[model samples]
Target: MDFFNSALGKNITFVRPEYFIITGFVGIPNMKYYYIFLFFVYFVSVLGNGAVMALIFLDHNLRTPKYIAVFNLAFVDLLGNTVLVPKVLDIFLFNHPFISYNDCLTFLFFCYTCLCMQSLNLVALSYDRLIAIIFPLHYQVKVTHRSMLTLIASFWAFVVTVNLIIAGLLTRLSFCKSVVINSYFCDHGQIYRLACNDNTPNLVFGRFLIFLILWLPMVFIFLSYSYIVYTLSKIATFHERVKAFKTCTAHLSLVAIYFIPIVITFTMSANIHPNARIINLSLTSIFPPMLNPIIYVLQTQEIKVSLRKILKTRMQTKVMAKKVIIM
Candidate 1:
């Protein structure tokens, strides 16, 4: 807030949310235990995603369109969680939820960016799988690294433009004296609801975005998988069918893990404690990023092989050092 005070005193004061109190997870009992659990989650998420990215980065064999998308997803997972977890933890532990308006918007921007990035990357991954399965011979030509990168760049531009429009509307809202964001972070809906002026525009647009962001990517994914299933049906051999199913196992698990809680939590939040619900929503947000790499590690033999190679190299290096010491 002080930094904002120093930076934008008179020039930039057009209906700003000065300070907001974050009020999710703070109401929970045993603050210490919650902190510990969150720390564990944060550590695991970083490690798991970082390891996957490292494997993809270092090994040329893993550098395909599929793994490239995986790398991007892992990156956003780490990014999204890092932005919120540490800050939210600070709020939870120290009772310091009062955040500057600028900072809140910053957090919101990154949150939406990460969400869109993950969703789009998943859609890309699904398309890659779809093409590979549906057009085995021409898949290589269709889904090249250069082509996927172009799609990624386009996706980045689109999501940023959309989110910027949302944020632009958010800045236009008028707030009352009591400017407190009642969530783990500055939720877009919560802040909009606090506006003193007519917020129907905000509400309508927000709802539309929810439908757009959630449903459209999922529809594409479903269509791709439906095509894959149709293609699989033409295959006669049982072993071949099993192999094809194995390829989709990781992605299907990740999609289920991500989507189920979103459907359950948002729809059912009204029936439960609002703070509890927001906390649960927060959990859902971070949990997928954490779980994604774990799912890959468990389901993907290539990833396991990479892990084994990494471990073996480290062990051999250690052995060489020990032998030197003995000499």
Candidate 2:
């Protein structure tokens, strides 16, 4: 209380509650089944993303600028879902929807940070593809391991700082109106709207975040692909053009999976029921992390090759151990 008062202004009095009730899935029919589905999705997401991260760590061939972005994407997806799903289950599934004020702010910080990073990681991957496709000859020079690492590190710094500001701003608002948050998680928008005092700062920043996290990244990706398409048009052979486009299929699929649902949900929000909107938003959050690794494994030849190589090596080691035991 003193901290928030000090941080905001000495004259201002903040009316914060001990806890806030989450009512995101309340009144929805058969919500237990939805929680069960989330459990399944979380399980698969852990396995798939873990496998991708493990493969990247174990294989030297994946130690390139491209896989650096891929590794970061997998990491963000794993973390984003990890921060979101378990708490969601605890709150709704286990019948514990009351989160303390400080805990809720912390939850908002980590979830929003990871969420922002997921989109920016996609931007990193898009940048990798843009350079690889557009400037094949200078790809290595332009997209170095050091450079990619720096770019990813910069993204982390930026996203973490932004979300910290968001969380900090939330501390200033006095939630005298209501303490029940209306989203699946401790969503920033939901929390701010509950404030009795002026939330213009929060509201303005929220809009800025929408542009920064969603629309800006989407625009960058779209432009990157457009450039890639333009560059591919210059290629003389149809086979080469097809091959080049094929390299992008996995990334394209990931972009679609990550953005399209979000776009639809937000655009159609007015027409959609609140319960339906909650379910759609939840699915949008959980689905990409589960699907990203699968799409990469199936579409990206390099990941497939790495998986087979690792499996073959493990099998050969087992066979050799059996031979030694027999002798």
Candidate 3:
């Protein structure tokens, strides 16, 4: 452990195995290409999610509960990308990657918050979909604007409280071990492994938390969707049912894209070659942000039309003002 504090340790600031994928790609023969690719991907993800969030907020016609849920999903995705992507981009720029203890804690907090928010968003969206499709008549009354806002507010508050509890528990523990985290971001699960104190409490509590936050919602999502399908079968209008199913396609796509990688990454972190942590994380984090916004924009016709309408209206307004000024 003293080696970590030595000049040698200072030179090798990153706490990862030499064989880590990031080490190979970032350290490799042609490092320029890797950095360029990383920058490009991050840029695309940021712009894409940012645009989706903006589009949803800007388009007044998209103020319904369905699109509102999509907007919230975009917001969570953007936040998740922000918490992880900039630090990852910085790592690409610097050689001696040393994040201070406080920085580590901060990163862990943001990462946890973003992830929990995303999971909660999915849960909320699942319920939203179940209601919209399964109980269309009641959706207006049950998922009223006020009700949606309340749900969103509660989801964010609950997630924050959960994160605070975990972070508070983490702060009391000291890290006497080497601080080399194998992954790009400071995931709580990964960070706990580096702590010197007894983590049995942390592990038990964390796993219980993991079960509550991750698996429970997933179960609900599945059950809700199952009941939704059953209800859809009872609807007589084939065309109406088809249209509702189309609406679900976007949400289902997002769920699959997000959950598959998350489950894979979690499994890898639990019991696989630690060297692949970066790959697993990139798959889970990097790719989803880029794809989620694209998925929503492409799948939803209303958003595209509304965006075009807004752009046209702005252009026409500018033209009219210019003509008046010239006169």
Candidate 4:
């Protein structure tokens, strides 16, 4: 309160609430099943993303610009799930929906930050692919380790700054109305609407956020792929073009998994039932992290080869240990 008063000026007094009740899944029937499903998703997400990160870290062969982006994606996925799932389960499954005002804002910050980063990460991968396919002759010079790290670092700085501004704006709002957030997490839209004071800043920023995080990234990816197709068309041989296009399959799958559900949910928000909308949005957040590593492992040849090599080495080491014990 003191900080708000001091920062917002003495003329404006903000009414802050102690806690907010999350009623995201309150009316849904048989939500226990959904909780079980969330638990399974979280478990797989942790394991899969962890393995991907570990593989990228341990295998020197995977220390390329593309795998740098892959490693970042895996890290974001692991972080995003860890921040979201268990809290959701506690809120809905355990029937504890109360979240402190500061805590709620922190939740919103992390969730939105990770979600935004996921989109930007895809954009990074798209850039990686676009460069690889369109400008293969200069790929090594253009997409070096320093350049990739710099790109990812710039993205982190931008996203974190935007989300901090978001949380800071939320702090100025007076929540004199209902303290019940309809979403599973501390959604920015829901929280802003609950404010009794003028939330015009939040409202305007919310729209800007949608564009920056979702629409802009989607447009970039679309144009990148379009250019990639154009470049591939100029290749002399059919097999060569096919071989070039195949590299993008894993990234394309990830883009679809991440963006498609979000597009559908936002497009149909008015027409869809509230419960259905919530379910869709929740799934959109949770599913991608779990599926991303799986998609890479299955689709990308390098990851598969590296995984096999690591496994074989471990197996040989185990056999050697057993022989020594027997001797």
- Residues 78-125, model 2: lDDT tens digits: 999999999999999998999999999999999999889989999998
Segments in model 1 whose C-alpha atoms lie over 4 Å from true places: 1-15, 324-327
Write one digit per residue (lDDT tens) for candidate 3, span 211-309. 977898889988988898888788789987787789788878888987888787777676865546555666576677678888877988887797788
TM-score, every prediction: 0.91, 0.96, 0.84, 0.96
Between the candidate structures 1 and 4, which one is better when assessed by lDDT? 4
Off by over 4 Å in 3: 1-34, 268-272, 318-327
Write candidate 4's Cα lDDT for 1-327 as tens digits. Answer: 786566546776767889999999998999999999999999999999999999999999999999999999999999999999999999988889999999999999999999999999999999999999888899999999999999999999999999999999998888766899999999999998988667899999989989999999999999999999998999899999999999999999999999999999999999999989999999999999999999999999999999999999999999999999999
* Clash pairs (backbone) in predicted model 4: none
Query: So what's the TM-score on candidate 3?
Result: 0.84
Q: Compare the candidates by lDDT and give the number of the best one.
A: 4
Name the better of 1 and 2 by TM-score: 2
Ranking by lDDT: 4, 2, 1, 3
Which of the two, 1 or 3, has more TM-score?
Answer: 1
**Candidate 3: residue 203 lDDT (0-100):** 79
In candidate 1 the C-alpha lDDT for residue 134 amounts to 85
